[model samples]
Structures are given as structure tokens and as C-alpha cells.
Target chain A: MKGMTIIVKTISSWVKLLIFLFGIYIVLFGHLTPGGGFAGGVIIASSYVLLMLAFGREFVEKNLSLTASSRLDCVGALMFVAIALVGMFYGAASFFWNFIHQQYLADRATEFKLVSAGIIPLCNIAIGLKVGASLFLVIFALSVFCNDFRCKGSARELM
Target chain B: MSDIPLVLPAFVCIPLVAAFLLPILGSFGRKGRVVATALANLAALSLLAMSIASTNQFSVYNVGRWSIPLGINMVLDGFSALFLITVNLVSSAALLFSVRYMEQYTAKPKYLSLFMLMVAGMNGVVLTGDLFNLFVFLEVASIASYALVGFGCDDEQLEASFKYMVLGEVGSMFILLAIGLVYGATGMLNMAYISKAIQNNPTNVVLCFALALFIAGFGLKAALVPFHAWLPDAHSSAPAPISAMLSGILIKVLGVYALVRTIFSIFGISTTVGTLLVVLGVVNMVTGAFLAIGQGDLKRLLAYSSISQVGYIFLGIGLGGALLAAGASPVWASLAILGGLFHLLNHAVSKSLLFLTSGSVEMAAGTRQLDQLGGLAEKLPLTRASCAVASASIVGIPPFGGFWSKLILVIAAIGAGVYWAAALIVAVSVCTLIMYLKVHRYVFLGELSETRQQIKESRGSMAVAMICLACLCVFLGLVFLAPALRAELLEPAAKVLCDGVGYADKIMEFSKDMIVCAD
Candidate 1:
């Protein structure tokens, strides 16, 4: 039974990992394509939900904790703010401004690339992380409460 | 299209930074709540100050100093400043109310933080010159509100939150898709630039489709007749202060404001668009008023009334737009827009006061059912007094704010030769009066309920907030009577919309001049 549980958890983790990667792809391509941070973040968080549903609360909690997601959310928000503040330092006057003075970087950015469009791509990435982590925290907290309720119910029955 | 100013960006940033820092001080408990409240209040106060200070000027802040087409910008004309004042003023009052009211919930810090974030999002939506940024901020506010609505975490709260989220998400998606279409067509995200592009190419099928999408999306956000399913449930289920904030300001800031900005500033107010808005407004007025009259729940009734009030605003603005397109005098257009804007401010104060009173009532009596509540005029004198004042204002009693705005709208409609629309306005106002009378009859009049004999007035900050807004509702009519204030604030905003297609030129010229001066 332990081995089977381990296999199931591993499969769930792999599924989550795949979804996370897909979310990353979506975020990175947001400026050039239709999908953006919001879509990507929701997708990533949905993956965690799927994993929790498949492997149970304890299994999911052991693998993915609320603390980590909270930290990620904070960091993501900070990064976005930092990028916005950079506009001030670069004399761009407001947030989310691309400060590149060189024609080469601007011209070379025409091709499908990460550094193109200056701060938009980076902002998108930050938004994705912030959204993903916040969503995960919300879902995980609810699940934790759910587990606690179930545990209390079973213990009451035992008594 | 007036020169985008630096103050506009600060309106969005101050609350955002405050929201970000709120959670960091969470371990200090009461101290955390105090700090968050202070920060939010200070931010709101500063925004109010700046908006007041910049009332006569139109300024634009180019995001990153880039040209209009290349980067995002924040615009602060009279219109934006007026909205900023309304948003900030209500937010400050709401935060004050929450100081004592939120003790019932766990994690007071989180609630304050989310509240500020929601304010930030609404401020951003009002101030942003970029279409995409408006949508983004709209989502930010919507998501925060959804969470706040469910803050209690009860089964009903969660269910309401879920329903709200589903509808809100659909609205956001539609808005995003509209933005995508606009971007694809014009290759520009700035409102002024998009407006210019649309004017240069008025026959784009894609633009028309995008406009349709926007109306639907923003209409849903505003809780117009068809897309109003989530509002009653969500608004009623939220904590009372939140219900007040949502009904009083959220729908206006996110829905009516955005719709007006798009239709007037971006699309230059076509006849078809005007007709569509008028039709939608009429439908919302009748439907919302009728629905409100039927509601037994206090907050639910207020929520439905909000939809009806919003209908009046839309009707005023929409009629103005249609008249303007039909070659009516600019003076009438200004009058209509002024009425709409004035009503927006009046509704924010009065409705928020009403909701806050409801919160006080709920706190004292432990219920919101109208039939179960009675003779509160004696039990909770302060709450009863404020509710009476707010009810008077909303029902368009003389000397109150609502009466003046409704009068202005009716006269403006008649002046513009839309007599039928004026009649609709009057009819709806009558319906509104009847609905509020029902509320008063059931909630505050009649014999005192036996169960609520010991009910006392809500203590501390809630009372202070309600009194402040109620005073505003009573005195707000002076804004129109005073020419300096009206000319300094309302007239400039009205002129911006009246300027119509010239918005793009103004933006480009201002940005270019700034760049040249910098060089």
C-alpha cells in the first residue's frame, strides 16, 4: 500500500510539473500571443488542485506547502513592483516603461524572443507568479480546513 | 485628452503600496490593523487632496515617459479627478468603518489589505489612459472583491463568492477579448491613440464588434438588467461595509466610469452607441427598481437600488452622447454629463451611508431581514437618523444631493429634445422613491420587534463613518449652487467628453511637448 501511494503521489507531482511548465510557456509568450499571466497562473493553480484531488490533502501538503506559495506570491509582487520602479530610475516617468536607448536591442527584439517588448514580458512573468502562488495559497488553505474537518468528524465517530 | 498629469499615477500607486505593506505587519495584531487603516486612510486623503488641488488642470502622466502609442499613461482631467475624489473619499470612510466593524472577522490585517487593493484597482481603472491597464485593474479590483465578499468563509459566503467569481471572470474575459480585438485592429492600447485610429478608420467591423463586447462586459460589471444575477447575491452576502462599498462605488467606478470613458473618450460617442446605452439604461432602470421593490433583504434591496441608480447615470450620459452626436448644443451635453457625474458622486455617498447604516443595524439587531426589523428609530437613534437621511437623499427629497442631480438630468434631457427619456428618468425616480419608502416602512417604522428590544446602536468607528457620509449627502447639493466649484471640477470634465474626437490630438500634443521640453 505504501509503494502504491508513493507511485500515485509521484504521478500527481509529474502532472503538476507538466501544468506548471505549460503555464510558464503561456506567460512567456503572453506579449506575442493570446495567453497571458492571468490564464497561465490559473492553469498552474488548477494543476495543484488536481493533484490535491488525486492524492489527498496530506500528500499534497507534504509536497506543496502554503508557506512556500505565500513566499512566492510576495516575491512575485515585489518583482513586479521593482520592475515598475525601474521606470522611475530610467527617467521613463512611470511604471512598466522599456528603457532601452539602443536600436540594436530594439531591432533584434523583433524576432520571437524573451527580451523583446522591454518590460511587458517581465511584467507578465511577475504577474503570472503572483497570481499562481496566491491562487495556490487560497486553494491549499481551504483544503487544509477541509482535512481538519474530516479528521475531527472521524475522531468524533471513534470516541 | 487633456494633458495627462503626474498626480493621476499617484492615485493608483499610493493604495497599492499600502496594500502591499499591510501583511508585513500582521504579527502585531491590533497595531497591524491600526497601521493598515492609517496608511489606507492617509493614501485616500492624499488622493482627495491631490484631486481637489488638480481640479482646474488636466494632466497626463506617460508611463515611462514614452510616447502615447508606445507606453501606458495615466490621465487626470476633471472627470478623472472627480472620480478620484469620490473613490478616495468613500474608501477612507469605509476603512474607518472597518476599523471597528472588522473585529468580528479573523485576520483583520488581510481584510484591510484586500480592501486597499480593491481601492487601488478601482483608482487605477479610473486613472489609466491605457485600455489594457483599465481591464487589468478591473480584474484586480474584481478578484480582491470576490475574496473580500467571501471573507466570512461560511457556506453562503463561499457560494456567493463562487457565483460572483464565475460572473466576474466571464466579464473580465469578455473585456480582455475586446481589448485584444482593439489592439489587433489599432495596434495601440492607449485610449487616445485608439480613438484616433478608430476616427481615422470609422468603418472597421472589428472595432464595432469590440465595442459590442465592451458594452456587454462593462454592462455586466455595472449589473445592468441582463447581467445582474451575481450582484444581489454577492452584495448581500458581503460584510455590510463591503456591501456598501460594492454597491456605492464599485459598480460605478468599474462599470459606469469605464463605459463612459470608452464610449466618449475612445469612440467619440456615435449615435448607435448612444442608442445602445440609452436602451440599456432604460432597461436597467425599470428592471432594477422593480426588483428592488420586491426584496425583503435590506442589503439586497440596496443592491438592486444600486442597479437602478446606475441606470439613471447611464441614461443621463447616454442621452448626452446621443444628443451630442445629433448636433445638439454643447451646453446641453455638458449639462447632461454634469448631471450624470453629480449623480455618481451623490449615489456613492448616499448608498454607502445606507449600507453603513445597514451594517450598524445588523450589528445591533443581528439580522438584516426587513420584516423582522422595526421601530429602530428609537432603539438606535443615530443609525435611524442616518438611514432616514440617506433614504431621503436617494428618494430625491428636496435639499438633498439626489434631488439636485435628478433635477439636472431631467432638465438636460428636456433641453436636448429627449422628452421621452426625461419622462423615463422621472418615472424611475418615482419608482426609486417608492422602494425606499418600503425600506423605511419595514426597516425603521412600525412597532418595535420584541426580540430587538435590547438592540443598541453600533459602537465606535461605524457611527462616525455613517455620520460623515450622511452629512456629505445632505450638503453635496452646494456643489452645483457654487459656480467656482462646479466650473473648476464638473465643467472641465464635461468639456473633455464634449471635445469628442479631438482627444487624440490633445494627448499627442501634450506628450510631444513634454518630450521636447525635456530635451
Candidate 2:
């Protein structure tokens, strides 16, 4: 029974890892596609939420504390603002001023990529971190506060 | 790039960068608070110096030196300069008030940081020459405000903040969708470029859809009658300085500033859009006033009153647009615009003053309930005096800033043959006066409550901030009588709007000149 439980847990964790990776892909490709930082971050958070539901709050908390997540959210938001300010240094009039260096096309005529296209991608990443952390903290806080049960024994066993 | 326009961008950058750093440093306790205060003060001083320097000159900073169509820009026109002054001035005052007032809250550094970020956001929105950048900054300010509103993390605060966040985010989404559509149609995001595109095409259906989206989005931010559900809760829930910031500056910068820029500079006001604004304005004025009268909570009442005051500014601008479109005298149109802009400034001062005073009262008497608190005006003389000035100004009493602005608006409305709008303005002013009177009577004039008899005066910084704003409230009225000052600032800004489609030509000429010089 113990071996069976361990196998199930491992499979679930792998599934969550895949979902998290997919979310990262969404955030990175946000500028090119329909999904952006906000959407991707929420996806990442949802993956964590899925893990927490399957394993338990203790597993998530042990991995990522609510306080730490909130701090990350703040840091992410700050980084986004900082990236916006970089335009001023470059003598680009105001915030979010894009300055593309070069562009290349590959795979298909429709598929094109730029090497240095200002701060859109940076903004996407910053927003991704913010959204992911904020959503994670919000969910984690709600669960921890509302749930009567507390984790016991080893942190891993809490899962 | 050589001239650098250092002061203008610094006004936004300083506070924004400080906001980011404040939380990390705030982990150090008292030292963090001191650092935050000093940084905020420095930013405010920079903004003041920049605002004073840019009074007569209109400057535009081309981001990345990529010219008009290719890069985002920051325009420091007289209108933007005036708002920049208002934002920084009020923020400075609020920060001064918070220096002592925020002591009751545990995380002072974090609070200060968020406050600065909010200021940066408002300043950015006002200065940005790109439509999408405006949206981005609007979100930056708004998200900070949402977090600040729930800073206390109490049940009421959480609920209010959640409601505010949901409504505000929806509004933001609408704005984004509008931007996407505009980009799709015009293939440009810069205001100047978009204006040129609209002038080239002039499609009614697309313009209508865009206008509707703008009205919905900005109206929600402005807390106009139809979209004011979350404001009362959010405003009342926030700490006093933040409450003042939101009611005073945030709505004006994000909502009114954006709306006016889009209509006047981008689309050039049409008859239908003008009429829609007027109708919305009148409805907000009447509804906000009526609702405010029934409120018992001091902050909640101020929140509703903010709605009413915002209505006046909108009505003035809307009337200006209507008259301009109808081929009325340019003088009357300009007068209407001036009134609207001046009222926006006045509201920022008096409403913020009111909120700060309310904070003082809440700090002293430990309650914001009108019925429960009375006659401690003697005990809290500074608070009483400041509240009186703010109340008088907001209610449109003469020799106060609000009165002159309203008078100009009414006279302009009458001149433009919008007699109905003029009448409504007067009616709403009366309603405003009555509500303020109730506030005065319940909170300041009646028999002193024994529970509040020992109420002490608000601390040093709060008192100083309130008094300074009160003084400005009196001094601002003198601007109307001074023709030269009025011509230099208000008239020029109004003319920028009255110029209408001519804006495209001006921008093109300006950019061409810059490019020629660069070459």
C-alpha cells in the first residue's frame, strides 16, 4: 500500500511539473501569442493549487511559504517598474518605449523573432512572476487561514 | 536628449524606484520609515521644481529618440504640468500627514513605498503621450491602490479591496480591449499617430465603439454615477492619506485625464460624444450629491462627494466639447475647459484636505461616525479649521477655489446656450452645500460628545499638512482674478483642446522640426 501511494504521489508531482513548465512557456511567449504574463502566471498558480489539492496544504507550504510568495510578488512588481524606467536611460521618451535591434524569420514566413525588441519580453516575465506569486499567496493564505488541520511529523509527510 | 528633461521624468522615476526599495528596507523598523519619508520628500521637491520651471515652456521627451510614431513620448504641456503640480503637491502633503498618522499601522515602510508607487503611477499617466502606456501606468497606480486599500487586512478592508480590485480590473480590461481595437484599426499606439490615423479615416462606427469603451473604462475609474459601486467601500476602507490620494488624484489622473486626452487630442470631439459626456456628467452630479447627504460615515460621505465633484469637472469639459462642436465662440469653449481643469485642481486640494482632516478626526476621536462625534472642534481646533475650509470650498462658497471654478463653469454653460446644464450645476451646488452643512453640524457644531471631550489635536505633521492645503484653498481662488496667469496656464491648455484636429498638424510639425535638427 505504501509503495502504491508513493508511485501515485510521484506521478501527480510529475503532472504538476509539466503544467508549471507549460505556464512558463505561456509567459515567455505572451508577446507573440494570446497568453501573456497574467494568464501564464495564473496557470502556474493553478498548477500549484492542483498539487496542494492532491497532496495537501502542508506540502505546498513547506515548498513555498505564503510570506515568501508575497515578498516575491512585490519583488516582481518592482522589477517590472524598473524595466519600464530603463527607457528613460536609453533616452526613449517615456516608460515602455520599445527599441528593436534586429528581426529574423525562421520555420515559416509567418514565424518571425527579434533579438532585442525593447522591454516587452522583460515586462512579460516580470508580470509573470508577479501574477504567479500573488495568486500563490492569495490561495495559500486562504487555505491556511480557513483550514482547521495542521501538518504533523516530517514536512514531506505533510504532503 | 542633451537637454535631458531630467526634472520631468524624475518626478515619476524617483517615487517609483523608492516604492520598490521601501519594502525591502522597511524590514529595519524606524530607520526604514525615516528613509521612506526622506525619499518621498525629495521626490516631491523635485516635482515642485520641475513644475515651476516648466510653467511657460512646453516640452516633449521622445523615449529612446525614436521620433513620434516609433517610440513612446512624454509631453509636458501646460495642462500636464498643472496636473503634475497638483499630484505632487497633494502627494507631498499626504506624505507629510502620514509621517505621523501611519504610526498606528505596523508596516510603515511598506505603506510609504506603496504610496510613492501610487504617485509615480498617477504622474506617469498624466505625462505619457502614448495610449497604451497610459493604460499600463493606470494599472500600476490602481493595483498599488488596491493593495493599499486592504493593507489593514481586516474583514471589511479585505472585502472592500476585493470588490475594488474586481471592478477596477474589469475596467482595466475594457481599456485594454479598446487599445487593441484602436491599434488594430489605426496601427499605431502613440496619441499623435492615432489622431492622424483617425483624421485620415473618420469612421463613425469605429469611433463610436472606441468612445463607448473609453467612457465605460474611464467612468469606472472616475467613479461616475453608473460605475461608482466600489468607490465608497474602497475609499472608506483605505488609510487616511491613501483615501485622500484616491479620491483626490488617482481618479482624475487615470480617468478624467485619459478621457479628455483621447476625446480632444485623439478623436477630436464629435457632437454625439459631447452629448454623451454631458448626460453622464449631470447624472453623476445629481446622484452623487443625493447619496452623499444620507451617509453617516465621514469617509464614506466624502467618497460620495468625490463623485459629485468629479461630475462638475466632467460637465464643464463635456459642455466645452458640445459648444465647440456647435461652433460657439472659442472664448466660451475655452472658458468651459478652463473651468473643468481648474475644478479638477480644486477638487484635488479640497477633497484631499477633507480626507486628511477626517483622518485627524478619526485619530483623535477614534470614530468617524457623524452622530457619535460632536463639539470637539474646540479640542481639535486645527482639524476643525481645516475641515471648515475644505467644506466651504467643496460646497462652492465664494472666495474659495471650488466656488470660482463652479461659477466659471456655470457662466460658460450659460454663454454656450446650454442653460439646462447651467441650471443643473447650480442645483447640484446647492445639494452639495446642504450635505456639507450636515457634516459641519453633526461633527463640529453640535454639543460635544463626552466620549470625545478628551480628544487631543492631531500630531505635528498632520496639522502642518492640513493647514498648508487650507492656505492653498484660499490662494487658488485668486488665480481666476489674475488674467495673465489664467491666460498663460488655463487658456493655453484649453486652446490645445479647442485646436481639435489641428493637434495632428502641430505634432507633425514639431516632430519634423526635431528630426531636421537631429539630422
Candidate 3:
């Protein structure tokens, strides 16, 4: 299917990068702020969604590719699960222990440091990647199934 | 034995890890489907082994060294352990059955992945001590089932999936609202702490409201009479193995186990709650049995029968609770609960076996219509025999597992002076017999149909799985008969409920001395 109008394409193309950066910022500072893995992941997915809207499903499929994004999704989840599993054996902690902070929190002069929360931020980033990829894959899958019969309306109507 | 507690996290962890890894690994090699199926079944097998090994044990795992009343914890008490076994055993069999049966469907890797995720979620729901965590895991399992229901992608399957999803979401919303209200009242999300708080101030209006909401939510999940509209369509439309999994153990875990645990262990069963349960149970029993007898499709008939059997379990347990609350007789109360728990186990095994046989029959004859099939006793001998065994158990024929549970329920009802309940149990048993007789007369005992000229017996893993489960169904009857076995297995589970609010005291006792030092 063809994409939307030139004006819509032009604005989304420029705005997508800023949205991606904003999502990364939220994910990175998730341990400190309200927007964590899930919220940030949704934002990142929306940026890709903007790209798909501006350039059509074919463009996104050609660029990111379905299999690559799926692999990315799995990788992100595995990374998070690995982090959690590591906590089980690390130090004398239990499953999901924040061992990093337990050992290193005292070394910091103040509590407001970036790496202060041990595993929380790392966990957040892992979850953000996983959720973002999964959301994009879901939208991509849904889009592929919407053939001529379903998407009879014009791109202008969608706009 | 000391390291047994470490096994708790692995219950949820192993499945999640396998689910995620399968998608990636399934893309490799010429035998990726083989590899993925093997890994998925390995995960399920290990779960079954672990649950059996950990039976009758009580322990708690504090995640990330988070202490009780704060960080999330997984509890493996007798009650949860019982559910753990039920979930894993059925899952192991279902996964094995799927190994052969799922060949008809596309996207084998995705199906295996979703199956593992569903296992993980059910395990989590059964084990979690935190109420909110229970909700999360319930959604995990529910969503997987929804997607799995629509896996066929046909109009019928998609419609069933949509119906199930909408009704299920409504139940979930009610549960979440109740959890929120509970936290508002007790300022705690942990079930044990909440129970303690409820006991401390047992007269809170909000907690009472929350209890009412809990019954409604969990009852919907369990598919009691009023909330059972989605069960028939969802159970029949899904693939056969999924039908087995959903009917056999999913409803019990999500609905009855959760509801009973919440009511008995957390809120502490009272006369009002107990009566409500009995009413719902009777309605479900009467309605389900009647509806089942009229169904033409084999799968639809079995699905309705699942609802009816679940009623017996609810009826038995609710009878016990009512007796316990009235201070009339703890003897009959324990007996009633024992019957209920036994019925729950028996139904899980038998119903899953029945569904698997239906799947086998459907695969063999290319139809689940009772009239189109005949004389399967000679053609698909293992499947026919397994279906017969399951039917015998379900219909409460003597010397079978279902007989003992039904007898126990009837005896408990009579001994407790609930004559109407006793009468109702007998009446439902007759109805159950009639329905199964219909299934047998139409599907297995008639003259061989002209369309079944080339019917072949389902061999290999399908036959192996069916025969193994059929053996388990027969063997379960002896568990109730053997005094030692009954004392070891069913008693502990029933005792957990009989103790009621005493559950919180035990949990608090276990978590008392352990405190993780913070920096």
C-alpha cells in the first residue's frame, strides 16, 4: 500500500528521530524517573510506527526486516532473563538480587548517581528493547494481514 | 532436601527462558522443529518431575533477596504444590500430544513458544504470594490461550478467541479493582500480610466488598453457571491439545484454585461466601449437564461436561466450608474438602485424556461429529479404549477414580445433613452417565461407517501419551483407596484450607527470622 501525503511524510520523517532519542532517554533514566521499560518501549515503537505510516509497510519491511526484528526481540528478552539468572548465583543473593548496588552503593558519595540502583537500569534497558521490538513486530504482522479487502480506504482518509 | 527451595524460581524461570529461546533456536538447522519440540517438552517434563519431587513440601523463595512484606515471594505450600503437579502433569502430556497433533497446524515454533509461556504463567499464578503477581501471571496464561485459540486463524476460531478474550478481560478488570481495593484497605499487596490485616480488623466493609469481587472474578475464570458463556466455544474451537489443556487444568488453576485459596486461606471462608459457592456450584452442575446432553459436536459435548465436573468440585469444597463456618462438624468438613480436592485431580487427568482421545478421533476420521463416526473400537483401539476409560471415570462407574470422588461427595453431603446436595450429586452422576452413554453409542459402539474405510490407529507418541494418561486415570482411584497415600497427598491440601486464616500465621512464621541487610 502507498503511504500518506507529502506533508505528513515530511513531518514524520523528521520527528521520528527525536521520538527515538526521547524513548532512549526515558529508558536510560527509568530507574530515576516515572517512565521505565514498558512506557519507553511504547514510545520507541511509536517512532517506528511513524516511519511505517510515512513510508508504508514495504519500506519498514525492507529497512528493519521482519526476521531481524523478531531476533532482536528474542535477544532483548534473553538478555533480561540472563541478568536475572545471574543474580541467583552472584554473591549470597537470591534470584533477582540487586547485588551490584549491594556491593557498590557504599562506594558512592551520593545516592542520586546514574549507576546507583545496580540492576534496575540494566533491567529497564533490556525490557525496553524487548518490548519495543515486540510491539513493532506485532504492528508489522497486523499490517501484513490487512490486504486490499480490509484497507479499502485511501491513505488520505487515514491522514 | 535443603536445596529444594531453590527449585521454586526455576518453575517460572525455566519455562520463560525456554519460551524466549525457542523462537531464536527454532530458526537454526534442518531439524529446528525437532529441536524446538524437544526443548519445549524437556521443559515441561522437568516441571513435572520437579513438582512430583517437591510434593508435600512447604517453602518460600524471596526473589532478589527481597524480604517478606516487601519484595515478591513465591510460596510452595501443600495447596500450591497440588496445583503445581496438576499444571505440569497435564502440560507435559499436552506438550507430548502436541508433538504429533500440532503437525496439522502451521507456525510450529510459535505454537511451542506460546505453549511454554502459558506453562510459565500458570506456574507463576500457582506459586506467587503477592496478589498483583497472581493477576499478572493469570493474564499471561489467559492471553496465551486466547492467541492459541485463534491459532487456526479461521472465522470460527477467531470469533471464539474474541469472545473468550473479552469475557476474560472483564474478569481480570474486576480482579484488579478488587486488588486495588484490598491494598487500600490493608495497605499491603502480599497475600499473607493482607490476610493478617483482615483478621486483625475482620469487620472492614472494603475488604468484604473485595471478597465479593474476588468471587465474581475468579468464578468467571472458573466458568461457573452465570459466567460460563465463553467456555464452550473457546474449548471446542482451539486445537485438541489446547482443548485438553484449557479444559483439563487451566480452568481449575485460574478459577477454582485461585478462588478457593483466596476465600479459604486469605479472606477465611464464612457462611455467606460458602453459601454463594454452593449456589453457584449447583447452578453450574445442573446447567452444564443439561446443555452438554444436547450438543452434537464431540468437542462441544466434552467442553460442557468439563463445566459440570467442575461443579462437583466446587460443591464439595463449598459444603465443607459451610459446615466449618457453622461449627457443626469439622469431620464432614474435612471429608467434603478431601472429596473436592480428589475430584479436582481426577477431573484434570480424565478430562485431558478424554480431550486427547477426541483429538485422536478427529484426526483419524476427519470429523468430530458423532453420527459420521462408528466402530472406532477396532480402528483406533488405544484412543477408543482411553476414551472409554475416561468416560467410566467421569460417569462415576464403580472401581474408577470418578466413582470414589462422587461417592465421597455424596457421603459428605449426607453426613453433613445436606440431603438436597446428596440428591443433586446422584442426579448429576446419572446425567453424566447418560451423556457418556450417548458418546459411546454414537462414536465407538456403532457399525463402522462407510466413510471410515481407511481409518488407521494413531500410533507413536499420540498412542503412548493416551495410554499413559489412561493408566494414570485408573491409578488415581487407588490413591483415594490407600489410606497411606490419601494421608500423604490429599490430606495436606485439604488441611491447608481447613486451617483457613491459619495460613497467614504459618507464612509469617517462616519469614520471621530472615532479614536481608541493605547498604
TM per candidate: 0.86, 0.85, 0.96
Q: Which stretches of candidate 2 lie over 4 Å from their true place?
A: A1-159, B1-4
State how far residue B502 of model 1 sits from its true place (Å). 1.6
**Which tens-of-lDDT digit does each residue in A1-159 have in candidate 1?**
012366676787778888878888999999888899889888888887877777775666687765566657867787787777766556535555566533236656465666677778888888999999889888866655555575645322211
For model 1 chain B, where is the 10-residue window of minimal lDDT?
Answer: B1-10
Ranking by DockQ: 3, 1, 2
Which whole-number lDDT from 0 to 100 does residue B220 have in model 3?
94
Query: Per-residue lDDT tens digits of candidate 1, residues B1-519?
Result: 332354566677777777766665553566766776677667767877766776766667877666667878887777777888888788888888987888887777678778988998998998888999998899899999999999887779989999999998898888999999999999989898899889999999999999889989998899988999999999999998898889888999889989888888897898888888888888988999999999999999999998888888888788888888988787888799889888888999999999999888888888899988888888888888888899888888989999999999999989988899889888888988898888888878899877878877776788888889989998888888889878887777778778877777887887787788768
Candidate 1, CAPRI quality class derived from DockQ? acceptable
Per-candidate alpha-carbon RMSD to the true structure: 4.9, 5.2, 3.0
User: Local error of candidate 2 at B76, Å?
Assistant: 2.3
In angstroms, the error of model 2 at B197 is 1.7
lDDT of 3: 0.90
Better of 1 and 2 by DockQ: 1
- Relative to the true structure, how large is the alpha-carbon lDDT of every model? 0.83, 0.83, 0.90
Model 3 agreement with the true structure over B1-519: per-residue lDDT tens digits: 458767999999999999989988876654987898999989999999999887788887788877878889899888888889999999999999999999888678889888989999999999999999999999999999999988887779989999999999999999999999999999999989999999899999999999989998999999998899999999999999999999999999999999998999889989988888888889989999999999999999999999999999999999999999988779999999999999999999999999999999999989898878778888887888899999999998888899999999999999999999999999998999999999988888879988777889868888888988999888899989998778668888999999998988888887774452233
Across the candidates, what are chain A's individual TM-scores?
Answer: 0.76, 0.76, 0.88
Candidate 3 Cα errors over 4 Å, as ranges: A4-15, A148-159, B516-519
DockQ of 2: 0.23
Better model by lDDT, 1 or 3?
3
Question: Higher TM-score: candidate 1 or 2?
Answer: 1
